[model samples]
Target: MSTTSQLAKRFREVLLDGLWIANTNFKDQLSNVNMEQATAKIGSLNSIAMLTFHIDYYIAGLSNVFEGGKLEIRDQYSFDLPPLESEEQWENLKSKLWKDAEKFAALLEQMPDSKMNEGFVDEKYGTYLRNIDGMIEHCYYHLGQITLIKKLLKQKESV
Candidate 1:
């Protein structure tokens, strides 16, 4: 296969790894979490709802860059999620995450292999490929946090 095909396949693999694949993915980690559970705070760490929004915040920003838009994100505001007051609100956040993940994967599939090595936005941010890979790593890092928080919440409930 051509390099472009290989790159596309790699991109899909990373995306799938983040979204599915049993124990590694958010689909199972976020499973059956109600609004209250999501918003539950354990100690000083961020709530699951906040972490979910934070993950999607980065995805949405990078996705804008891939779509030829500017990256309009700020670190200070990434975790500023509104209250997940109801199941409907939590569902909406989850829906947005799934849709954005799909859109991001589609964008990757359409990317030209030649452009992967090009600088993303500016040289300071590194190459497009690096940024994309970073997104996957970032998700997993936060996914671990989310999973731990969920487990802690469950333990608290059981006690």
Candidate 2:
């Protein structure tokens, strides 16, 4: 593979690793909990459900940009993905996020060199590279939140 291709592949791998951590640590648990339960605070943050949404949402958003599209966000968006209307809704998005992530990763992996450096630009960030960088960082950032959420969930379960 070419250097650019290699870079994109590695980037996909990083995001995939994030996907595994997110899905295993949180999304899989959504089936067992209600919306309120999923959004329930362990302490400081909202809950695993919301964090999961934020993670998946941004991955999809950035992936779309890499795929030659863009989505509008308010003030750089936030890390917290809110709860759905009900447990059922949350369960649905839970599944959709996984599928969306897989598709996102695949599209990003195909990104060509010419396009990787190109994307909707903002004065603050400038270039798709920086935004993509932010997207990657965002994943790991929430993985930290997910780790804490998982620990809390385990504690709750054991008690």
Candidate 3:
């Protein structure tokens, strides 16, 4: 497979399905989470919902760039998750994440392998391959956090 295709596959593995790396994808982990559990606090760490919004924020922003939009996402606003007071709101957030993830993967798959060496957005941002790889790594990092938070939440429930 081409590099772009491989990258897309890896992206899907983390956000959608496939279990080669963490043994659990975002879909799997979030499927079991309700609004209460998602928003529950585990010490001072970010809630699962906050982490989900943060990851989706970057994915959607980059996907916009892939679709010829301007790079407008900022780190400061990435965690600005709106109040998820209801189950519907929580579901909507997850729905957006899944939709954005699929779109991001599709766009990545369609990208020319030659463009992988081209700088992403600007020369200072480094190459498309680097950004794509960085996103995958970032997802894994937060995925680990979400998994641990879920465990802690479950433990709290049991007690």
RMSD of each: 2.5, 4.0, 0.6
The Cα local distance difference test for each model comes to: 0.78, 0.62, 0.96
Q: What's the number of clashes in each of the models?
A: 0, 0, 0
Candidate with top TM-score is 3
> How big is the positional error of residue 82 in model 3, measured in Å on the Cα after superposition?
1.0
lDDT of 3 by residue, 14-106 (tens): 999979999999999999899999999888999999999999999999999999999999999999998898999999999999999999999
RMSD of 2: 4.0
Instruction: Name every residue pair that clashes in candidate 2.
Output: none
Which of candidates 2 and 3 is the stronger one according to TM-score? 3
Q: By lDDT, is 2 or 3 better?
A: 3
Steric clash count of candidate 3: 0
Candidate 2, superposed: residue stretches over 4 Å from native: 2-37, 75-86
Model 3 Cα RMSD, Å?
0.6
lDDT of 2 by residue, 1-159 (tens): 753455454454444442543444333344466676667787677577777777777767766665666565453465546546776778786777667766765675566657556645555666656666666667667656666776787788799
Q: Tell me which of candidates 1 and 2 scores higher on lDDT.
A: 1
